[model samples]
Target: MKELLKRYKYAPADQLPSYCIPITVNGKTCGRLRPITPDTLHSEEEIRLLTEWRSASGEWFTTQFPVTEHGTRQWLEQQVLQADDRILFFVDDEDWNPIAQVGFLHYDEVKKQCEFDNLLRGRKGRFGNIMIYALLALGEWSIRVLDLQTGYLNVLADNARAIAIYKKLGFQEETRTPLVKQVEGDVTRWVVAEDDDTGGEAQRYLVTMKVRTEGFYETLKQIL
Candidate 1:
């Protein structure tokens, strides 16, 4: 039988079950990864999470998000589901429990470029590293199967942990810029060429990571 995650219901749970795609490394299906969604979009979450994330170290929620479950579900569906969008992968646990998600967004057939959106682990889970493994494998698959020019993500400058993780996965800083209207605040943009080994192989990933809503980062990593 094809493996699948056991369903679990939560507050106002109304969205579809998250997707799972097999990830192969060295010709073996080692794991899987979950991607970001519309309701789970980080355009705003990055900012909110940074506010509290800065105050604390490690991963754990200090407070609750302001939005309702129903509202969040509706919003994510609209934002994530679009033409030319192929996938978001959620890495599952040993018992087939989802623990994290990462999105490889805006697949451009003509330009051969796809952007890496959100990559986050659950507040409660045991397979955090599995998710990272899945994401890295997925990135390689995305490059080969999708015929991508480059894959990338925009991370908050202060998020040293995430930046470090990306670097280990063969991503490098392509550029950094200030977020509009916020003096002294900026987002570090990380980019990677498919075969990039020295960090800067030469290719422009065509995608703009932007904040679409205010204060949406805290819960933006959650599965809707």
Candidate 2:
């Protein structure tokens, strides 16, 4: 898995696979999961689109800040493309138009585990629940090809829609931690504050969920 991850991370974007996987629904390809590359950010418009998605979806995230194209491109280069343990993919429709983004991060080679990160439907109502299949595709590849033992994700406990989707994908809730918003300058980040009962300014809880790799593919098949 480490070697494969290295290839995905270090290999030339053009040389790597065109897509991480193709998402299928009802025996038809609905979208493709393409890794974000330099080519993906070649155009200023592309960067702006990504920035818009992040800004629009900020409410569901722990951190909220004014998103800018400069910041977005910097993050893509330093935090994503340059990182060895993380890989981000843009979910493109059948026509190859990017509609969403999903990826895995914080890979633990020793434990064969990783966290599902940055799932956002940038363009809504275009694919019609295709994000679920896109997630399943990534999860399957992570387990079958990358040989991961478990997959995990952290979601805002108040995000009922996202929580339901994760549950449908076979992730079981493991823990929930109370969070308090900390504001500094233009950024506001939700930080772990205290126990669930010590409610003062902490209004949100972060929920961690896990899914075993053993029956991951089977679960995908069942869903499909």
Candidate 3:
């Protein structure tokens, strides 16, 4: 319940990277970025967002991962029950006020990957950048502190902005199957990955394709 802002020193329980942690960006306090637990669910603002996100059966959800109220309720209820499943984060302002929510849902422990989904911010513009910075900070914290080797996400293929951001953060297109159950009406799967376990060639291609191609070019040059 502590306000996580600007260089907050809080650490995660059980050393899991997905738990709530302190984060800051460019020397400014970013506030407490943590998992959405029943304990933290008491906030009115949090409850409001949860309700709206559920009711939003709007065009986005309908087009992306359509489901009924019952289905959505079941999933939200499970967030509190499943041990490995992390409601990754719903950030609050300094006063325990909910600002935006972003987290990895549908976690697959065996694969050490999860889908980075559900980001809702009340404000616009720089809000996206703040949430993204927070996510990367958590990624590093999870990797170094929790020993997680990889993270993955599924973005809406049409979401160019989000795709660009994930790419900028080093997530690459992947063929991994969708972890979330897609209703019959949903769209095709689109996924991305970041990890220590990427195949050597895949990693090379992802990290520096030009360099790899240049190496091949030099080899051919030498042959010629």
Candidate 4:
């Protein structure tokens, strides 16, 4: 699998086949793993909510807060407009407003593999299993639509809550890299995903896990 740091020219985001799959829990629609467009309405509040969530959740993500209105627009453009790789989108349900996002950061169609990053769920995510249901929606899409065999998830070793969630999803830890500290200003803790110290720094170290999409679709079909 290719690390996210390595970049290559990818087809335009519009040219790629979209896998914006929605998920339901119990009888209600919880959220979705939808595709993002230039017109997607994610305001500064949503941006700040995600930023605060990541900062509080530790190093699974590295985006910081105080993203001003202008800065938030730039960040959105960077993810969908300026990005040469990775396709990003919102996860919306009841209110048609997004509560989270999913990204295919490193895509290798030939290898049937991709790494997911920028999975952020705000305080209004799910009831209890916030992250699980979101991931299931995306993971199911990865298997069915993308035809991917292996999905890579990067996380921090010390984030037990997140690690347990991944394990339940059948992701197995594969690699761990000793991350160098990179902190700007006063951070209560530092954890990292990539070399971008902008998020914070690695709490302990950076670790990646791999999961196959073999049984995901079959399982989701029965439940959702």
Candidate 5:
């Protein structure tokens, strides 16, 4: 199962169920992660959940995304399906309950680099370690099988909590710039999860960071 995760990109989309990957946080049940399927592509419930969660996480997300269920599904197809990216769903290991969603964005096979995107955490805050494990595994898999030499991701510079987590996972700052202006109508106030979370407000930096292929595998040692 461990080796299979690195090569699931070639698996027939319909046969992805057999390649499910287990994920846990703090030794507690977080969920199982598997490749996206036809069910997730059309499920209205998932559409609602992702839309609501993205809206709630205003300061973190970049764009003014689609809000309606149909619109969200369309966006998913463009971003994950047509974009040649592998999207995975975070679900309960026992009963197959949906927990969250994550995926690679703009993975350039020739460049040997990719941007990680759509990584939203579930509502269970106490089991926060889920993000760490998810990212660690993804980073390892990227280098191990995808022939990737580097992994890149962007985060709000003001999002200290997320930045800290990224650092702990062995990602280091590579560049920083102001994020493109959000075109959402009358954007005034934004909501975030962390209380007293500094550096996340009207003034936000679009920080780009990366972890080398070797560093990704090395991170596993730190976490373990």
Candidate 6:
């Protein structure tokens, strides 16, 4: 599994192995989840779209910073494509146009656990339930193909919409920790801070949720 992940990460996009999850409704294909690679997004327009999407979804993330094409391209090359433990996929329409991004990171080889990270729906209202399908597909793939024992994700406690969707997908809350916002020039980071550090008025609460690999496929089946 580790070797497979390494190949997926380092291989050129054209030479990469096929790993796609198709979204279907009533026997008709609707969208897919395709792996994101540097080669897959070498075009200027692709980088621009990714930058715009990341910038637009800033409110839901732990780090807030102005996203730019240059930074996004660098991140794609360094942080994503070259990282050994991270893999991101594009949520695309049936025609293969990217609509959103979803992926996993922080994989623990000994524990067989990983966190589902970088989930953002760039195109709103176009595919209402596409993100849900994308997550389910990713979860199933991780458990079955990668032999992951557990998968988890963190969400803002006040994000009712995302929490509700996560509940429906069979993730149960594990913890809720207070977070404090720390600002550094041109950037703001949400860090887990002690209750006393925030003077009883923390900036936000981060809710961590986990799902067991044994029940992952069953949950996907129920949703489908």
Please, what is the TM-score per model?
Answer: 0.54, 0.91, 0.57, 0.69, 0.77, 0.91
Residue 135 CA displacement from its true place in model 2, Å = 0.4
Off by over 4 Å in 1: 1-20, 23-30, 34-65, 123-128, 180-224
Worst 10 residues of 1 by lDDT: 1-10
* Ten contiguous residues minimizing lDDT sum, candidate 2: 194-203
For residues 1-224, could you state the per-residue lDDT of candidate 2 as single tens digits?
A: 55566566555666755545788888888778887777756778778879999999998999999999999999998888878888988888888788889998998888889999999998753568988989988987887777789999999998999999998898999998888878999999999886653465567889999999755766787898
Give the alpha carbon lDDT tens digit for every residue of 98-177 in model 3: 66667654445465445556665554333446666666556655555444545666544445666676665666676422
lDDT by residue (tens digit), candidate 4, 55-141: 565545443344355655676667554565567656675555667666776677688888888776664754556457777877776
Worst 10 residues of 4 by lDDT: 1-10
Displacement of residue 27 (Cα, Å) in model 2 is: 2.4
Compared with the true structure, model 4 gives a TM-score of 0.69
Predictions in order: lDDT:
0.46, 0.84, 0.49, 0.62, 0.66, 0.82
- Candidate 3 or 6, higher lDDT? 6
Better of 4 and 5 by TM-score: 5
Task: Give the Å error, residue 88, model 3.
Answer: 2.9
* lDDT (Cα, 0-100) at 68 in candidate 6: 92
Candidate 5: residue 94 lDDT (0-100): 40
Q: Which stretches of candidate 2 lie over 4 Å from their true place?
A: 9-17, 195-201
Q: Which predicted model would earn the best lDDT? A: 2
lDDT of 3 at 119: 60
Better of 1 and 6 by lDDT: 6
Scored by lDDT, model 3 comes in at: 0.49
lDDT for position 158 in model 1 = 62
Better of 1 and 4 by TM-score: 4
